[model samples]
Target: MIAAIALAFSFLTATAQAKVLELHRGVGVHEWLNWSPVNEDGTYIWPPYRAEQEWLDSFRKGTVSKGENEFQRIRSMGFDFVRLSVDPGPLVSSEGTKRKEALAILSKAVKRITASGLRVVFDLHGVNQVPATSMKLIYDGADSEGVARYRAMVKEVAGMLVKVGTDKVAIEPYNEPAYYPCDASGTDDWQRIMEATVADIRSVSGDLTIIATGACGGGVKGLLNLKPGFDDPNIYYSFHMYEPHDFTHQRSETKGGFASGMPWPASTSTPEAVRKALEARIDAAGLSRAEKRANLAEADPLIAKYFAENWGEKQLDARFEQALGWAKTNAIPSERLFMGEFGAILMTADGRMGADDADRIRYLTAVRRSAEKAGIPWSIWEYANTYGMSVIVPKENAVPDMNMLGALGLMRQ
Candidate 1:
């Protein structure tokens, strides 16, 4: 009876929290088991990852990995939650003993993360892979056998989550679905599959908070375009914010090093200004004369497009306002609207390409403030990564980026 009463009280608390949208400030925790770098030979490539319990035990103990408490460091920096990205590929694709072990790891991860005093946003992140992960399987279409299998997986995961309790964790059923166009032209299959997936979760855990997202790559346009046929108080709407991908994902194409230093708020920069910076960068690079000319020639068009787009705080606000309006139209509370991911790439000494520190921080401040002003809780793109978008320098025994913390409005430790 005591256990049942405690569960009831927790459910009420979770419901109340959703009623007013308890702000969940967090960062994306990736690659721990998220199918990153799917081995071409189908062998595990994630090093620094031993057994799940061993690593999770160390994480909670704060005695391993970074030589300090990592989760504790995140809390010290003022984040209260983590968007734990888990790949569903193995669990759904496995059977019998293998599947049981996979589910055990999932439970252990949630238990340890919560024990560390952090809420978990169980983000079922999927990727398009040959062996078929959640992203590809689910994206194959709403009625596909893959979707059927995934729904069953969702049901099981939801059961595990409920046992963990609703207040400490919420489930986002899918990552950026592939429904493109975000209009009548776009397929409505995602909507059906999403509704069905929610039903599957609800079948077992009715009170567990579910995060529903629009299709079209899960961006503002997608969320704005999504129409959740029904409303549940426990359900919060979610969307990703990385507008002007050129700026945030800059230099992702190649290490050619031409598109590195673009600023936030396109108005703060001009074509000539960026070209001038690139010229200096190229000169400092000491490239052969032909290479220098070739780099500049390649840079001119991208620079022109960046200026033409004219992205800035006003534009960011405009996008948020549209999402806000979508919430209002759908009768969803603004606070219930979740910004699941957003971050600007920072320049690194290695081949990683992105904005310089000053510009990157300025852009992050703009995005973070935009979400805050809209009363939307958000998680930056990631905690650590080789791609220049990390909250910490991705390395052995890594530490936080103080400037990044300040920019995200997180307390710098």
Candidate 2:
């Protein structure tokens, strides 16, 4: 049955090739989980927060219609796929009544997206946000019981997707595994979690592609100490890049919050600066030096081990080379590797909340050029958001820079 499904999907993909179903050339539409498509009291509610239940109602009602329309707009702009932020917590309500309602809303959204001929990657963004000790039935800690629960969650989601016939759905098990620091040795238990999660999912849906995130959303270094037995064909190693977070998260004086008025040195973006900073931090922290050195020593052949990896081209060029070298030494194929997420901030020299559109374009162009030269596929950081390549203003106005998106290969024309 699994073979048959794979064959059918393969055929569908092949036939759809003329439509340019380029997975590597995709862009993410971040904050989909909090986004709503409805207006309240003459104001549009975007980035709907959890506390705003009324706004959520309006948003849910509008999302099926509005979400589809937005996706259509994206597709029209020449994008072939979207990375959706999906939280299964809402779908699995504590109360029976709420569970049904949540499922209905999600089903509607999924149906609309699939019908539009666009592939969707269901990212489990906030599993641990729930009150339960065990989220998605996967154990947060190494305890036996937690592991059991985590497995249960994985099986449940896999079974649900199978029933829905959402063949294009790719599961991102956890959003950012390295958000919390691990041991001093830099030993994160991701391999254990991935192994168990993959086993559960494969049990239910034999061929579901699973995208595995690295620790702290960094690159291949996080996966170095992973136990050897966990590798699987269906697994796609994934990572997220929001480099020199100071740059990406910088905000203006008027925008008062965590990101406001933060200063990031311009030198940090340079290759030498990044290498120095990374080396210094690694040395100071007394973490993972031996493993990193060993990996770099054998870097030539390990490049093919990863299915996809994300990084900022300018900020982490040395790290990228190290990773690629390892893959090459390990005899890993280039096609299996990819740059999953990357983009520059739209900022000016003075660090205000405005678009330095040319710099953004240049950054993307350089990344794309480098990836193409390396024979690696890539997905730009975003679409239809301020941080993304395009900005989705309130109401119907989507201020899209066709040239920028075009440069990133997100927009064909």
Candidate 3:
């Protein structure tokens, strides 16, 4: 009789814990239907060439099928969520037809994804992609026309989800506010903007979950400093993790400021060693000797600082400790604090596997294990694309990059 009573108590305790500790594992699907091509003058090509419209139509139809089929595959692989990155261009456009088309497409995608048993985190990523100079156009005066339009678009989008009648969709008002030191002081303009946006979203649908993030490209420190002021149980804080950026983004195609062949576990390459390689490369490039000397002088300190900092398993775990520490400080549970993005590039721009795939795998494994240990849910940077970190290799017969999937422990079988 005592054994039966103890078993019942244990069962109840486990059920309660499961309810409180549900964590979302997801991938970011980016720049598909949401991207609109623009003309040289920065104007959207409306009634996009019929060929373009046909391509878009085919893509929309294809996305729905992919959501049902391809996404199903991911779900089977143990992921249950999708962080759908969206560009607000068409949704916020002055062109009525384009706006309608954009809304319809997004609604269809969301419905299909949910129907496939995968939850969607609809993110307004386009806001951060706009150039800094033109950002004012999106965040004009306090009660600016731009602000009103943005709120309207958000409300409409939320309403569409509410109509779909599924609690699986969450709305992220903005991605990477890029506003630092958001405080009680009014000088933090972006904080005010975000608060207003959140308030507007609540007014539209109180039942919808809201995901929020902070400035400085939404780094963990930004999340630590965000003072969202009001409290709502459904609101979750998110931050991207790419600590020791030099290691994660070294020799990037877009910003290869550092020397190549920079190994992971930083101890593998000291500053002096890296400097020698940089000098050799500069020499081979046929730069003036004076230019070579100047470049080396500038790169030396950066290389030194990069290698001196965190770059291995212990250091990676310490990075998550900062995030876990922040959650504890705010009285937020680990389940509510998400590591929204983190991944290691696996290839160079020239389509060659990165010089150090083994090390990249080690780094990715470290990040994955750290997030799990800290109970911080995270989504890999992307699912498929030309980007080095994408897990899916794009081709005639697309397939998952087993090396990356294995490193991250996402293997289906």
Candidate 4:
């Protein structure tokens, strides 16, 4: 009788512990898992990797070969999840051979990541970006040919998920899907395509969690307008937070020309400094006084729009509140809301820290803490890099940016 009771107790304990885990705190592991490496020639490579076969084999064995213990390091930082961003183009091909090879590589990665005890959000990122090939299905999946191709990709991926099992995995249909205006029409179009994609995935695996997002590069406003067709319990809505792009992406060539040396709080001094910088730039361009004034007029609003405005904790709070309000209005629970990406660029256009460590820390702590307090799960944009907002500083001996980690509360000391 005693032995039977003990066995029953053990069984019950195991059952109780097998709860569905939600991704709360996480960091994006990034483009490594995404298959988009280009060859030296202008032509794109097939497997999307530029590395040698031996190194690629090691990656399958859970060794990144990039001289870092990725899984162990992420766990040590108290992050519960890693959003593996995957590029779908290279994974799906007209010929079965290339597609199968890519899937095998991805399968190895998913297995290695899951075995490390970290939850994985397998994000189908960058499908919307115009690829070298003539596939526009990601943008026009609502159409006939587009929908057919998109559905096929999802179907194949869902089958793979069945093999990986949905224990610690979730699928994000697309990343940063953008359409103009973000109005009712755009939202409806996105909804139609997303519904189709979800249906396609469900046809293969009904138990897998599906993450949905809106258009406008998956911004907050876009997410606000996204409404899932069915009230499925396993669906999550994700938004990327990089508001006041001038403030966040300043000095990055990606956003525009270099916009560096901007402050967080946007004091009177901040704008004056910006104005002076603008004037100096205009002067160097050999513009006359009238031309310079015109240039300043043209540039002033942008500076004010991004930085001169009040952008303290209150601003950040209000931004988040808008999302929370939308969620409440839609009857969506907070647990179903997620901020999938948020981070600041550390490097300036000239390749230096844009803001002082103190200012950057203050800004990071405010945004991250605010999101957490709102009961929303969040992930930093990246883990390791020298030029971006990465917590790990790259070197021969990689080192953690303690200040950045401290700001995110990942480091106490």
Q: How high is each candidate's TM-score?
A: 0.87, 0.64, 0.78, 0.80
Query: RMSDs, each prediction?
Result: 4.8, 12.0, 8.5, 7.3
Candidate 3 lDDT, 1-413, residue by residue in tens:
99999976775453333222234688887645445556676665664222323432433434434324666876776777888877676567644667666677677878867777888888877643334313344555446777677778888777777676536888876777655454444355566666787777666656667777776578876776667674366677888877667666655233333344456778766777766766766666676777666666666666778776736777777767877887787787777877778876664633222435776777778888888877778888887666566767644345677887787787833
* TM-score order of candidates, top first: 1, 4, 3, 2
Q: Which candidate leads the pack in lDDT?
A: 1
The better-scoring model by lDDT among 1 and 4 is 1
lDDT of each: 0.77, 0.51, 0.66, 0.69
Residue-level lDDT of model 2, residues 1-413, one tens digit each, is 99999986875454333121235556665555533332454222322223323432332433444334666766776666677666545443323455445545655665666677777666665544444421434435544575555456556666655565646666666666552354355534566666777766766655566666556454555533333354454455564544444444444332221111212223224434333433443344454766435433332122211111322454456655655674566454544455677665564323323224554565567666766676665666666554433433222344566667767766544
Q: Which stretches of candidate 1 lie over 4 Å from their true place?
A: 1-21, 36-68, 255-257, 350-352, 395-397
Tell me how many clashing residue pairs each candidate has: 2, 24, 0, 1
lDDT value, candidate 2, whole model: 0.51
In lDDT terms, how accurate is model 1?
0.77
- Model 2: how far is 216 from its true place, Å? 2.3
| Cα lDDT over the full model 4 | 0.69
Model 1: per-residue Cα lDDT over 196-236, one tens digit each? 98778766765787888889888998887778775678788
